[model samples]
Target chain A: MSKVTTAANQFAARRGFNQIANRLFTGIVWLIGICTIVFICGLLFLILKKGLPELDWSFLYGLPSEMEEGGGIGPLIFNSFYVLVISLVISIPLGMAAGIYLAEFAPATKFIAFIRICVEGLASVPSIIFGLFGIALFVEALDIGLTIIGGAVSLAFLNLPVLTRVTEESIKAVPKELKHASFALGSTHLQTIRRVLIPVALNGIITGICLTAGRAFGESAVIILTAGVSSSGEMWDFSLYSPGATLAVHLWYVQSEAIVPDAQLIAEKSAAVLVFVVLLINIVFRVPLWLNERKTR
Target chain B: MQSVASQTLIDIHKLNLYYGQFHALKDVTMDIPEKAITAFIGPSGCGKSTLLRTLNRMNDMIPGTRIEGKVAIGGADIYSKEVDVETLRKKVGMVFQQPNPFPKSIYDNIAYGPRLHGIRGKQKLDEIVETSLRSAALWDEVKDYLKRSALSFSGGQQQRLCIARAIAVNPDILLMDEATSALDPISTLKIEELAQELKDKYTIVMVTHNMHQAARVSNQTVFFLNGEVVEFAETEKLFSNPRDQRTEDYISGRFG
Candidate 1:
């Protein structure tokens, strides 16, 4: 009878220990989640509180002044968009084609494996290193100086690896059965990729583009090195060879070395706009994926 | 069914296939009659599907795959250097075990093949889509929802739609690789009936694991074992009184 009582006590102790462990794990997980939420919320609140008061129509549409207290970011915004367009136009076709060749056409050889490893290494390299490379290649060697084309070309180099990797993964995710069906229906290799493969992988490709666009939008190091830290002449001057300062670079300049008294205010508003645009891009890309899931269900 | 009067549509002569060093098909030889359903039956890994894929050179897509000897369809050698694989495949369409409809509108899925073949006019595409769907007996079910995504259909309907898509190209032969195995019994029966009707117009070659399915639908049945043809005879004779001892054992459920 004594032995039986001892066994029962041990069993009860083990069950109690298990319950405590489960509760501890649950609490730790919840704490991590809550901490992340709190951190993001706090950051957003601080930025909005400091920036929203200065965000007026004139701040958006007005010209920047060298000596005055009130200055606008109109030319900076235009230059940012113009550089983005040039980069995308250069990178999208080349990246997607390279991705297709790697994913579908290239045989598994030692050389191919080496190429893959190089691409992965390039993807992990710092953006600052790309800035240095851009200065060496475009600004100095090519005699382009600090121009919009130089900056856009540098940004294209930065975007290529990301777009290539995304395209490769998306193309690889397409079902093998679909390819077989296309071939059995008498489609040539190129025809099958054009008609079936691209359409299916389009969603993932768009997501990749949005990701690259967001990264390029907030990029300052490469733009500063290649496009310079200042713009001259009229607000709408769109020459490819002219030096341009993008919004992110302008924010950095305003905070550190602007002669204007309201530099801090301009920096805060620019930060807000940058963050908001990135969030909007993410939402725009994700909505299609969500709608596709809903429709299939 | 083997009365020696029907013209041979596909003639395989001493066919041997290999994937790298592994021999997959061993000296396969068979004569498929025109306008008839020929069913291939065996246990798993028996190379029945491999042989079906070889008919249209689908095995060419695999790396390090090699084929020796001859495969002729309608007295023309398909493996010759002069023969274009794409044109060969156009004459021999295939359906897979799983129903694989493109993630597009029903009308677009049906029109995909014709469009690839350069059928661009809207009215011509509309006529072909309707005719193909009608031939596969899926017209009335999906006539109202031509614009709806093909993924929205039931499994059976999707399979039939795939059949319609295959037929839209108007191929002379159809190869089905265990096409009904993934469907329900009712869907399987419908497909079996559809195959029977299709044989009147197109030469049908099907690979199936189901012995009953082979007995029920095919005019000629070929049994495979270990990458070789064990027996090839009329369906009734092969089931009722298989000449080979191994065929008898397999049909009697003694072994795989």
Candidate 2:
């Protein structure tokens, strides 16, 4: 009787230890989760606290002044959107096609594997290098000094590898059975890609496009080297030859140069706008994914 | 082993199939008759499913698969240079073991094959969709929800939807690669009955793991072991009095 009681006590003691350990582990995970939420909330609060008061119409739509106090970011905003749209137009279709070719048509030879490695390597190359290449090609060789076309083209080059990798991975993620089903139903290679592969992979591809677009919009280093730090001072300048200074570049200049008394305000509001626009891009792209999910569910 | 050559819809002569260096199917020969249900039964890795895929050239999708000898269906060698793979696939529709319905609506899944053949009229497509689903015995269950996503259906219903999609193209041969292996027994019975009914029109060739399934539904049965044919005979005779000892042992649960 004493032996059995001792054994029971030992088992109960071990169970007690396990319960305490489990509680500790759960507490640590909850702590991490709370920290992440607090950090994001604090960052958004800081930006919007100083910025939201200055987001009036004149500050947003008025012209930038070199020496004056109340300059608007109208032209810079236009240039930012123009550059993003142009780069996306150049990159998306080409990158998606290259991805499809790699995933479906390319044979699984050593050479193809080598090509895939190179693509991954290219995706990781620093964005500054592309900016330098743009300067060399457009500004130096072509003698077109720091223009919108150079900046947009360089941004497109930076977007290409990332887009290609995303598209290829998403296409490959589709179940092989789906492709087989399509083929068994008499679809040719091209037909299967158009009807089945693209539709199924659409969500991932859209997410990729949004990420790249948001990154391209907030990019300053490439624009600094290729498109200069000043806009053409026209709110509606459509000419590719004109200098294209995006809102991000303008924010950088105002923060560092501090030429006007309102520079601090401009920088603060610009940061808010940048973060807000990026969030908008993600949400907008996600709408379609939500619709797709509902259908499948 | 052979069925009557004159009535054969699928004629195989000394067939061999290799995956890279691995010989998946050896020099096997058989003839499957038209408008009859034929079953290929064997253990896993016995090349039975591979043989079914060969009918529609689905094996061509694999990277390094190789085939030799003859697989002539309807008097045409499918491996001939002039044969269009897409056309061959159209004439020989396949249903896989796991139901694979596209993420589209039920109507769209059934309409996909017909749409590929340029049937653009709304009325004609609707007609095809209804009849195909009806023939597959899924119309009564899904008729009200044609716009619902195919993924929303139960597994058995989705398998039926796949069958409906396959027949929408109006093929002469229906290849079922273990079509009911992934289903519950009730769903399996439904598909078995459908197969029997379909044999009056389409030449049905199936690969199955269940020996009783072979005996119950098939007109003829082919037993394979290690990529070679062990026996081929009428289903009833094969079950009751298998000619080869290997076939007898397999059916009587002596060894696989």
Candidate 3:
């Protein structure tokens, strides 16, 4: 009432209001974060609780039963890993080469921009579309039928654009100062790329590789269309001509169409395995990089 | 003002550079003395660094950049068709404002340039690394930790390591673009002293924002403004007695 003009008193009401609002906002954010973590944990728990008891070595490596109570996914598991390795072998080098060319060697032209757009568009395309393309190329064109090679080539196609984008971004993220330094030392552009840029961008590239690897490992639709719904029924078939149904495909098959009485149990266990391995892939790839960073720093 | 006559190592003739539609440097011509330090002083965006880059053809990396000039180093026209850019760069080394030591061991950092030129022997690489580090006044401090990562060093030490790396290739000319602008005062003084010693063997051309650094380290000084050379003279005479109003005004801090 007396119109006190002290600095602290002048803004006291606003300051107090701000403090309350700040705390309220912080509380809401924390609650949201905790809820998200709880949801994820609940999902993981639901799968593991129903599946972990049934999971065992023989169940993982035994042959399937058409009308019996018990069946395993040994050949399916083998196909999953085999297809993954082959696809990576096909995609990694090609993708990284394309990425390097785009980032370092491509001239600043409209044609180059168009190519970049094409790569980005392909990276976002649906995996099912790639499966269809695989069918066109392998099943229709080459007459190979549903086979491991077809599945792997289609998976490679899916992986290529993602890998290229990730690699280009990673290389582009390397500091300009590093490139300048290398060139100043009279190193050729090719030499600088190999000796400096690749090494520096390797961490981000590896992370991209892990992410794509996880996606490809658990991929279902592509394998279903291109590799078929059945494995060769052998534990270790290395031939590319074999039917390459993977664990993810088998999980879907058991739940939807398989005649086995314990199909639900098998699906649950395989889903758990899929999630667990995806999580494991990221950790395994990143730990060595983290350790090396610590050792240097 | 006295002009000390010396053998010319680098001769620029009517150099004009354009970044697409924009003219970055115009009609720049100067003769750099052999085995002496020449400093280029100008404000930011004054084309000082651009001219320095032209010496080694580093500007070739920039897209939409065009040049019409003859930059002859040691009597060879570097811009001519027969001149291989890689070989020219090998003869003319560069250091940048920020200390950019590779993410490698200190020994490997110094050895990288030599290795690129095909010095594969362990003993030879060891010797080059030692001599280069000693030349940069960094050998004693880093000798015990030669295996340590270059990125692990302090700012000043890392800059010295970069200098050592540049020298390991044994270039005839060294171009430093604000090499000490990012360093502290003590480190700056250390580098200035190092530059003074380096001038005895290599022709050094440096572009610096610091007027004091130019006065302290350079034998010849060139003042540039708006892509034009305002004055070029011996450093001592130019500092004490100016011949051009723009150069004097810039030197006196009237306008940068």
Per-candidate chain B TM: 0.98, 0.97, 0.98
Per-model CA lDDT versus the true structure: 0.90, 0.91, 0.91
Model 1 Cα shift for residue A119 (angstroms)? 1.0
Q: Cα deviation in Å at residue B1, candidate 1?
A: 5.4
Query: Which parts of model 2 have CA positions greater than 4 angstroms off?
Result: A1-21, B1-6
TM-score, model 2 to reference: 0.96
Compose the digit string of candidate 1's lDDT tens values, residues B72-176: 999999999999998888889899999999888899889989998899999999999999999999999999999889999999999999999999999999999
Q: Residues A164-192, candidate 2: write the lDDT tens digits.
A: 99999999999999999999999988999
Q: What is the lDDT of residue B184 in candidate 1?
A: 100
Write model 3 residue lDDT over A106-153, tens digit each, in one string: 988999999999999999999999999999999999999999999999
Query: Model 2, residue A66: what's the lDDT?
Result: 92
Best-to-worst order by lDDT is 2, 3, 1
Predicted model with the maximum DockQ:
2
Question: RMSD of each candidate?
Answer: 3.2, 2.3, 2.4
Which residue pairs come into collision in candidate 2? none
Q: Residues A1-297, candidate 1: write the lDDT tens digits.
A: 577755554445455778999999999999999999999999988887788776888887777878788888888888888888899899999899988999999999999989888877887778888889999998789988998988999999999888888899899999998888898889988999998888788788888989998999889999999999987645887899999788888999999988999888899998987787677777877888777644433
TM-score of each: 0.94, 0.96, 0.94
> Candidate 3, what DockQ?
0.69
Which pairs of residues collide in model 1?
A: none
Off by over 4 Å in 1: A1-27, A283-297, B1-4
